[model samples]
Target: MITGASSGIGRVAAMQLAERGWDVAVVGRNPGRTRDVAAAVSGTAFVADYNSLAEVRALATALLERYPRIDVLANNAGGLVGRRGRSVDGHEQTLQHNHLAPFLLTNLLLPRLVASDARVVNTASLANRGGTIRLDNLDGTGRAYLGGFPAYCNAKLATVLFTRELAKRSPVTAYSFHPGFVSTSFGHNSAFVRWGLSLLASRQISAEQGAQPLVQLASVDSLGAASGTYFDGLYPNGATARRAQDDNLAAQLWDTTARLVGLTDG
Candidate 1:
């Protein structure tokens, strides 16, 4: 099951996996595009806006009803917000969309994933190197959010922390990855970021090239590495951010996020 499958790495990864004979569940915010991708891949399509926790819950319920066993869940639906906006759920938009929403959906489907022994692949970023995890100020209630790019970086740092924490607490394997700097419509909300992406075309990789790590992690039969390992492309990364490597911080973030999403039993 792949979120954000209507475009970019998720879309290409869905197609690639379908070509490999895997049944892909193509999920996205756009109904028409998501359905089109699903049709192309001969797979299922689900629509959900991560800005709404209710929508995230509905997506989880629908997914559980549709698939008996979800082999791989790619938490790939997220992007940068132009400002410190708020979701319908009353949290920071970037944090909610990128981290909280996926956190909720994954936990909601935890039972089925554990039963199926599924692997979870979170799409983090190299920008995580610039991020800091503040359990006390995760929502960026004040001037802490900085802006779109900084918030995006912090949210991605949360992604890695969540993956490691999940691996420790759950039976299923979990991994996070940096997909390089992919050329996509990822920073549509931030003009500065978009300009940066365009100006640095030499640093950007194709969506297909970026999807390789996700496809590789999702398609492997036996991932011999540790469950919570972070990947830099196809290989394990030794230089994860210091904050992301903090086990205590990861646990605290997991517990705090669980509460924020209204999950009582984390």
Candidate 2:
């Protein structure tokens, strides 16, 4: 299953995976766009707003009921909300959309994933280097102000830690990756960031280029053994940093996230 599969890196990944004979489930917020994408790949499309937990739960239930044997789950449905926004559940939008939604959906779908010995790929970012995991500030409400970049980094960092902890408890192999700042509509909602990113166009790669590593990781047999690792592009040679490797911290973050998302037992 690929979230955010309607455009950008997600779209590229979906197309490549389809060409390689993988039957994909494309999940996106826009029904029309997702239908277009799914039609292009001969796959199915699911529409759900990740910013809302109720919507995510309903989508998860539908997906589980429809596809009983999922071989791979790409948690790629995440982005920065333009301003400091709140979700329908009163949680920070970035935290809800990027981290908690994926976490809940992955946990809910673990049975299918493990039954197929699935490989899970999470789309983290290099911006995570600047993130600090503060259990007290998990919701970003305690902070005086929240910016798009910082909130995004924090959420992606949470993804890495969550993947690591999940690998520890479950039989599923998981990984998080940095796609190398691709040219996408990622920052389109923020004019300032868009302008700044445009200035760095020479350093950025195309969405297809960025999706290559994720596709390789998802489809390669060798990567099945390398669980709970962080990747820069296609390389998975090193750990994410001492703090990110802390299993205890990861557990704490997981608990906090569960509470925030109202998934007490997840």
Candidate 3:
């Protein structure tokens, strides 16, 4: 199952996996585009907007009902919100959309994931290098809130931390990766983000190129690395921000996240 599969790397990856004879589930926010992608790939379509935790919960329930054994789950449906805002669930929008929403969905489906021995691929970014995960301030507001890309960076860092904690606590394998800056409409809402990416235009890669890492990680039989490893493309890279490497921080973040999202049993 791939969220954000209506466009960009997610769309390309969904197509590629379908061609490889995998039954892809294209999850997207836009109904029309999602249906188109699903039709193109001969896959299923599930719609959910990550801004709302209610929607994320519904998506999980739907997914659990549809797929008996999910092989791969790509939590790829997030972007850089231009300004500091609150989601319907009352989190910093970036924190909710990029981290909390996926966190909730994945945990909700944890039983199935463990049973199927599924691999989880989180599409994080090199911007994670700029992130600092403060368990006290995930909302990206007040003194800690540096809006725009910093918020995105922090959320991506949370993604990596989530992956690590998940592996530590579960039987399923989980991986997070930097997909190399890809040209996509991901940050179209943020003019600053667009300008920043434009400055690096020469270094940008295509969506297809970016999707290769996700494809490889999802399809490969053996990664030859631990479940919590983060990758730069297909290669394992341990050079994350200091906070991202902190197992104590990761565990704290996991517990905090569970409480924030109302996951009492976690």
Give the best candidate by TM-score. Answer: 3
- Candidate 3 wrongly placed segments (more than 4 Å): 144-147
Least lDDT summed over 10 consecutive residues: which range in candidate 2? 139-148
Candidate 3 residue lDDT tens string, 121-176: 99898888899887888875675443388899899999999999999999999999
Off by over 4 Å in 2: 142-146, 238-242
- Reference-based TM-score, model 1: 0.96
- Clashing pairs for predicted structure model 1, backbone only: none
lDDT of model 3 at position 258 = 96
The predicted structure with the larger TM-score, 1 or 3, is: 3
Q: What is the lDDT of residue 3 in candidate 2?
A: 94
Report the lDDT of model 3 for residue 33.
99
Candidate 1 C-alpha RMSD relative to the actual structure: 1.5
Task: Please tell me which model should have the higher lDDT, number 2 or number 3.
Answer: 3
Q: Give per-model CA RMSD.
A: 1.5, 1.8, 1.4
The Cα RMSD of model 3 versus the native structure comes to 1.4
Predictions ranked by lDDT, top down? 1, 3, 2
Give the TM-score ranking, best first: 3, 1, 2
Model 2 residue 42 distance off true place after TM-score fit, in angstroms = 0.8
lDDT of 1 by residue, 1-266 (tens): 99999999999999999999999999999999999999999999999999999999999999999999999999999989987788999999999999999999999999999999999999998888888888888876665444488888899999999999999999999999998889888888777787778888888899999999999999997767799998988888646778888999999999899989999754
